[model samples]
Target: MKNKTVAFIMAGRRQRRRRWILVTSFLALLACALCCAMLLLGSTIYPIQDVVRALSGENIKGVSFALNTIRLPRMLAGLFAGFAFGLAGNTFQTMLRNPLANPNVIGITSGSSAAAVFCIIILHTSNAVVSIASVVAGLATVTIIYLLSRAKPFSVGRLILIGIGMQAMLNAVISYLLLVGAEQDIPTAFRWLSGSLNGSQMHELPALVISVLIGTPIIVMLGKHLSVLELGEQSAASLGVNTDLTRMVLILSSVCMIAIATATTGPIAFVAFLSGPIAKRLVGVGFSNAIPAGLVGVNLVMAADLVGQFAFEVRFPVGIITGILGAPYLIFLLIRMNRKGNL
Candidate 1:
C-alpha cells in the first residue's frame, strides 16, 4: 500500500507536468513567429505595426499590397496545408503502425498529383476542376488500397508493402505524363510537382482551410478511439471500440484534409512523414500527439520554405528541401525496421 501510494504520487506529478500542453504551446508560438517572419521579411521589410495595420484593412501603399495580397496568402497556404499534412500523416502512421505508411509513401499524394498533372497536361482544365479531380482521385486511391489490404485476416505490413508498390506505379505514371506533356505546359506541371508556394492567392486558400478546420476537430475528438485502434483490432474491439466506424471516420477525414492540402501545396514532400515521429519523441507516450504533430508540420513547411528561399544561390521548392531531410530518415528507418524483422 505504501509503494502503491508512492507510485501514484509520482504518476500524478508527471501528469501535472502536462508537458504535452507546454510543447504544443511552444510549437504554436514558433509557428506564429515563422508566419510573422514570412510576412515581414519578404522583398522589403515591413514594421510589425504596419503589418498589423495592413492586416486590419489599412491601405498603406506598398506594404499593404504586398502583405494583404502575396505574403498573407502564401503564409496561410503553408500554415493550413502543413497542419493537414501533419495531422493526416500522423494519423496514417499511427493507424497503420508504421512510419513509412504516410500519404506520401502510400500513393495518396501521388493519386492527387497524378490527377492534377493530367488536368494540367492533357485536359487543360481550370484549377478548380483540377482540385476536384485531385480530391476524387485521392479518395479512390485510398479506397482501392484499403480493399486490397483487406484480403483475408488483414495485415498492416501487407498494407504498407502494397502502398509502396502503388506509390512506385503512380510515380512512373507521373514521370510518363511529364515526358509526354506539351512543351509550354511542362513548366506548369513541373512547378506543381515541385510543391511550390509561388504566386499563392486567396482564392486557393479556402478549400484547404475549410477541410482542415472540419477534419482536425473530428480527428481530435476520435483521438481516444484512434489510440485504442493502435492496440490492434482484437484488443480495440475488446475495449468496446467500434473498429470499423472509427477507422472509416479517421480515414475519410484524414484523406479529405490530405487531398485538399496536396492540391494546394503539391504534397510538400515529407511534412507528413516526419512530423509525427518528432512529435511522439518530444511528447513521449501515454498522450495524444495529434496537435503537436500538426504544429510540427507547420514549422517544417514554413521553415523549409524559408530555407529554400534564402539558404542557397538557386531557389528550390519547399518539397525539395523536405525531401532532402526526409530521405535520409527514410533510409535509416528502413534499415532499422529490417533489422527488427518488421520489413
Candidate 2:
C-alpha cells in the first residue's frame, strides 16, 4: 500500500512537470512565430535574411531602414507590453483567487490612462513626462484602493468593488480632460486613449523593457508564494508564507509592469484581463502559469494587432480588436461568477 501511494505521488509530480514543459514550450514557440510574422509580414515584406542583417546592425537599403526604424520597435513594444500585462494580470488573479481581479478590472490601467490623458490634454506634457505620470498615478491608485479595501479579514470582493468604482470615476475624469482639451491635441489624445503602437519608437520602450526584465523574474520566482496566497491568508500564514510581505512584493512588481506597459501602449484593452484564465486553462493546475501567461499575452497582442491591421477596410488600433475579443468573455465571466455567488 505504501509503495503504491509513493508511486502514485511520483507519477502525479511527473505529469504536472510534463504539462508545464509542454505548455511553456508551446507558448514560447507561438510567441516566436508571431514575433517573426510581425517583423516579416508588413507591407513590402522583408525576408528573414534582411531582418537578421538589420538586427545585426548592418545597413541594407530599404530593408535595413524599414526593419530597424519601423518593424523592430513595433514588435518589441507588443512583445514586452503583452508580457507585462499578462504577467501582472495573472499575478493579481492568482493572488486574489478571483478571475475578475485583474488590473483592468481593478482600475490600475484606468488610473494610468487617466493620468496620461491628463498630461497629454491639460498639462501639454511630453510623452516622457506623460509616461512618468502614468506610472506614478497607477501606483497611487492601487495604494489607495488597497487601503480603502483593507479590512480586518481582507476581502477580495471589497478590493475588486472598490477598484471598479475607481475605474469608473477615473474614466469620467478622462472624458472631462478630453472635453476640455485643445482641438489640436484631441487627435493625439484619442489615439493614445485607443491604445496604439502607431508611433512606437525605440527610444520610448526602455522603461517598459527594463521593468519587464526586472519584475518578471521576481514574480516568476514568487509563484510558489502566490499559489500559497491563494490558499487563504490564515492558511498561508500558518504555512510560513509571510503573507503581508509576499502580497506587497507581488502587488508592487505587478503594478510596475502594468503601469509601464499602460504608459507605453495606452492600456491595450483586456490583455491583462484575458491572459491569466487562458493560460491557466491551458496549463492546468499544480504548476505556475506566470511565464505561460506572459507568453500568451505576447501572442494575443501580436495576433490582435495583425487582425486590426489587415482584417478590416478600416485599420483599428490593437486595443479595439482585444476589446472586442475580451468583452464577451468578461460578460460571460460576470454571469458565471454571479451564478456561483463568487461576485
Collision count for each candidate, in order: 0, 0
lDDT tens digits, residue span 1-343, model 2: 9999999999999998899999999999999999999889877888898889888998898988788788889999999999999999999999999999999989999999999988998899998999999999999999999999988788888999999999999999999998989999999988998888777899999999999999998998998999999999899999999887899899999999999999998989999999999999999898899999999999999999999988889999999999999999999998998999876
TM-score per candidate, chains pooled: 0.96, 0.98
Give residue 270's lDDT in candidate 1 (0 to 100): 88
Q: Per-model C-alpha lDDT, please?
A: 0.91, 0.93
lDDT of 1: 0.91
Candidate 1 RMSD to the correct structure: 1.5
Model 2 residue 100 CA deviation in Å:
0.6
- Alpha carbon lDDT at 70, candidate 1: 89
Best by TM-score: 2
Which 10-residue window of candidate 2 scores lowest in summed lDDT?
A: 63-72
